[model samples]
Target: MPFPHDRPTRGSDCDCLPRPSDTKGSDAKASDPKPSDPSPSDPALPVYVLRYQDAWFGMEKRVTFAAADLDAALAITEREPIGAWAELSQDGVLLCRRGGEPGGAADYWVVD
Candidate 1:
């Protein structure tokens, strides 16, 4: 549906409003359905990408995984091949593997 800003306001002659031929309450339930609660199969667990620079030689790498906690995700990423120099973000900032090189800034999506 187009945004309200993109459409013209309804006037007295506008036929978009409810008509006598339309079934009111029958379609009302379908129009505004209640949202279901989050479940394990609902894909509620948050997903994030772990990004860091290589320790020995500077190289950027990212790993994506689903985890409940950020710490747990970091722990899982640490077990991977790049675990040695893999730096986890402390305050959701860039994870620095070496002293000088900083990870590029990019907004991560939080899966609902």
Candidate 2:
């Protein structure tokens, strides 16, 4: 008895995998669309700053703040005591309006 053998078929109907370069152009365009300018409704976005005990001293600690809106929040943070950080959250309840170290000095307090 002889063993059965199968031959491979080649045609458009065949299910061969595509080569890497086959979809390069179209895929590149779709994947690399030009970035757009910032939108008004973008999130507050988080940022941080370190306050050192002194100019030569290493970072003493970090301060945190949150802006309900991005531009206003950034502006508010910019005008603060020294170093301030900001983060955007749908729920920033843990964050109080007050500015200070998480467990240290009290800088500014947020008023409801």
Candidate 3:
């Protein structure tokens, strides 16, 4: 199916309008169908962005990842390490790391 942008839309529903078969832009014969994309669809994993500094460039580098969560992102970074000081962002939102193992929530702050 042709995208709305590739072919003019029909109406408010935004359906692709079919091209005339008898003409080429109403001039000559029509051509073959548009070729479909061969690339795979987007990953289902949760999106993550790792923020780190580059040692060579001495500038910050942002690396995006599609994984289960921050833990999964960290695992990939461990294999192909980015930088010593790095932070993780999930779905484009930056997240803070938990200081310790799971215990009581008393040490943390809360709002009403």
Clashes of each: 0, 5, 0
Write model 3 residue lDDT over 8-103, tens digit each, in one string: 454345535544442455643345433442212246567776676554665777777676655666676554334335666676566743122256
Off by over 4 Å in 1: 1-42, 55-57, 82-112
TM-score of each candidate structure, all chains considered together: 0.34, 0.23, 0.41
Residues 1-112 of candidate 1 have per-residue lDDT tens digits of 7654456654434455565555654655555645664333346666656676654566778766666666666567656545234545433665434222346543232322
By TM-score rank, best first, the candidates go 3, 1, 2
lDDT of 1: 0.53
Least accurate stretch of 10 residues (summed lDDT) in model 1?
103-112
RMSD (CA, Å), each prediction: 12.6, 11.3, 15.8
Cα lDDT, model 2, residue 9: 41
The 10 consecutive residues of candidate 2 with the worst lDDT sum are 50-59
List candidate 3 stretches off by more than 4 Å: 1-43, 97-112
TM-score of 1: 0.34
Residue lDDT tens for model 2, 22-60: 677664455564556343344544533323222233334
Of 2 and 3, the candidate ahead on lDDT is: 3
